[model samples]
Target chain A: MSPRLFRSRPARVVPAVIVAIVILAIAAALGWVAIAAIATGGSGDSALSSGFSGFASLGAMTWGAPPVITAAVIIALLGLILLVIGISPGAKRNIGYRTEAPEHIERFEVILPTSALASLAAAAADSVDGVSSVRAASNASSTIVTFSTPVRDNDGIRRDVDAAVTQRFASIAFNRTPTVKVRVQRRQA
Target chain B: MRRMAAGANRTGLIIVGLISLGAGFAALAISFGLAATAAPGLSPDAQLQPIAAVFALPFSAGIALVAALILAMIGVRWLAVQVPRKDSAKPLRMQEDSRSGVTTVTANVVAAAVEDDLEATPEVVDAQAILRGTARRPELILHVDVDERADFDTVVADIAERVACNCSQALGVPLSAVGVEIGIARSRQRRQRSVQL
Candidate 1:
């Protein structure tokens, strides 16, 4: 379940589905209109035969003027309603894909076995194209692998350097993965 | 499941929503029939029709609207639901984040995996392994080159397996954290092979 879905309000769908179900209910009423007329003729021949019997009774309004038309409308509406209800759960499930840990791991660290791997990682990283200089001796835990590439293109250069380092180190095990920070040392375009 | 349906509370709200939806529809049907029947001579003011009468009630349609909204909410209800359960929980997760934090997962996984690798082969004389990961960058690990006489492929396979296992264990952590870096390469002469007899 995606935590993001919770952030979005689901209130918007109801109006649309309700309007749709109502329209469906209305169509359903139309589908049953002929049958309603017939059934009403059979049961309430005195009513429609009497030509739009002018609201003669509350029971007409309470249940339905011609009963079966009401039944038709109700049945169709109920079916549509059930569909909307049934689909709602499935819809939410469809767009949901992310999960967040409730406990929230704020910070953690792992010590590396040696600085040699870090240096090699730095060396291999510096060798990549577009890189201007490697801040191998920075006090920072991450390598400030500066790039000669343009600022706008620094992202691409950084990715390339990162990829190169990843490939170079693919066959070995290290305690920390070098984070290549791309700073544009110089740029032409 | 029943408990889940009600926001992990009693199923009161959902039931209420269900009943209200039904009632609202029933009311709508009745109102439609009344209006359709009274269509001929209904007051020209257009407000006298029973459908109009029902709509005037305000609360009923609102209830139906509420029911409809509730029904819509079901679309995300499952995802929004925070159930404390796991059916197919994998022991490892390899989520890569471009930060030093990812390095920790890589390290843990790589370290744990080294043991697994050692268990598989006989000639690995206490190999040392390193691993690290970052989101802004790809992961890296240093396998401290060891046992000059050992088969390379076997060593590689052992380290890879260890990295993969640790990667899975560290959900959201990358396998690249396990870099087989040879921090020290000392040729320790083979001690007397302990006879297991």
Candidate 2:
């Protein structure tokens, strides 16, 4: 990935929105509760006292009721979802690998997009004999090339495709060379 | 720092949300008579006592302060994450003159020129350059959009070579790092002629 693309992380809009809404709701609730406490002179007379007191209590919680258990489960599930979303590496835009420049060149890096890699791989695989068509998918770690050929020996085509792709990848000075895999199937007559 | 803040933002929000959500649901559940039989002796009025007492004294103010701080923290991180950052470092000296005043240029200016030059290329549709680090040792971030049919490798190499050469000789500064991102431009649709009868 380009350092610029990686360094300039995209804003987590969904998470940010969730956080904003939750925080605002909680802030509003706290404000209301605090106001109610002050309005009632901290007396046990306020209507919200029941909810507030229950929350403030540090004693062991009674978990006998079905409604309480159900509510707890739902809330726990929601929290788990949020935690997963927050902690997990979310969807990332495809940015290609950072490649080393040619020898005797000044310090510079070229980021080749995954699309470009796939294109290059497909082009290389297409050059092999008996390969009717080629489709390739690539990322920073690996490239998978699948081709259809009408030839008798699919295995030979696969090997040829693999070798061609390997050669192409070897020529590029990628920060890390991706493993190449080739799949060949006989084309339908 | 931005990445760290981003991670913290998510963690903090999820943690706080879980606590608040759990408490709210628990209170509602108890009110609805779920597991209400377990605490046969406890009443709705009774639960309020612990909370009221906690918020009655200095603890009330403290809770309020903490709540405000949490809200502020989430809010600030959300805003901070939205702003794009280019790493800042030392400034590069462009010229040194004994009799005349010394001349200097920021990495940003060099990057802008490079961006403009790249965009001027026939194959390139648009480009942006973000300069990072100090003046003497700058890192260039080049993002370019090229004609979809253009030769991807050749265009990238051409842009890199041009930018590196231009910056070194023109700006007289050695770059510490350079990174480029290339995007294929969408094909333009041809317009149809309108006929007036």
Candidate 3:
């Protein structure tokens, strides 16, 4: 089975599929009208004669017409949106871990998702003495840990939780260490 | 991770976007009389009859037919690549000499063995592996879920030093690349059958 080891960015499949379908529709319509016109020798009585006449009448509309201007603006806006999607690099998904491989190993990469890192931080903070529970949230560069404790004297517990969580992260040896922030909240009786 | 035509999608979007932008801008330019200097006949007040008359010609149908076919092909190709792919490597020939008996190992078999080996580790709850590249220069990609309370450093060290090393020895070749992704499992679901005294 295949494993999605790293988070991938959006592939813009929706917009691409939409554009493709639109192109297909346009192609079908154009082909139909062209084939009908050719088969009927451009006769006015043909079924597709109205479609041809519609196209011919479009030439009568001035470039300054409101409908034409509105369509041009919409098309331009859509083009801009697609251009941005194609150019943007999206977000980073993985937190890299430092690796020291043996000489025989040519390449080694280790990664952990932000969610897992947060879980690890929460577990570490919870293991500290006087901490009743822990919640953690992490991003690429930082982790925020919140602890709920029954103890009245919060200073010592806060320090201990900070040290424990920081030490836990240090042991993992990430490629870039995320700064740890600790918040202690007193539990209600 | 599953393979996707991300590059193709980006390229297609860019091409389509440029064309749309060009058409829209050209229309706007003509509407605003910006292009009147370049072609007096294409003024903002000018009727589209001159352009529409081209379609009344005999060859216009043939041109439309060719353009329709090209657009249809592009659309079909774009639609086809929307499906995700695994792109796994083929069976590898592990034996050095084909003249004697040959040893062939499928990627799935190697990946399964690696998964089992990873699960045997103390804190690992679940694991998945994919073996890629040639036999002589094999690559291992893994996803491991470990208990939140487990020692992350020890688990990672075990994978690099023991599991990967064992696989390399079994295949009689050094691993060219190894990528391990770690996840945390909040709950332990694996049933313990034996206790270590």
Which candidate number maximizes DockQ?
3
TM-score of each: 0.21, 0.61, 0.77
Residue A22 of model 3: what lDDT?
95
**Model 1 regions lying over 4 Å from their true place:** A1-146, A149-189, B1-54, B57-59, B65-69, B72-156, B159-197
The sequence of per-residue lDDT tens digits that candidate 1 reaches over residues A157-178 is: 7778778666654533333334
Give the Å shift of residue A42 in candidate 3: 10
* Residues B72-168, model 2: lDDT tens digits: 5766656556554565444566566536866666666777788888877888888888776665556667778776446556676776667566765
**Chain B TM, every candidate:** 0.30, 0.66, 0.82
Candidate 1, after superposition: displacement of residue B57 in Å? Answer: 5.8
RMSD of 3: 5.6
| Positional deviation of residue B172's Cα in model 2 after best superposition, in angstroms | 1.9
Instruction: For candidate 1, give the DockQ.
Output: 0.02
lDDT of 1 by residue, B72-91 (tens): 45533433443432121122
Cand. 1: chain B TM-score? 0.30
Assign candidate 3 its CAPRI class: acceptable
- Select the stronger candidate by DockQ from 1 and 3: 3
> What DockQ score does model 3 reach against the true complex?
0.46
The numbered model that scores best in TM-score is 3
Q: List candidate 3 stretches off by more than 4 Å.
A: A1-10, A28-53, A118-139, A142-171, A179-189, B59-66, B186-197
**Candidate 3 chain A weakest ten by summed lDDT:** A42-51
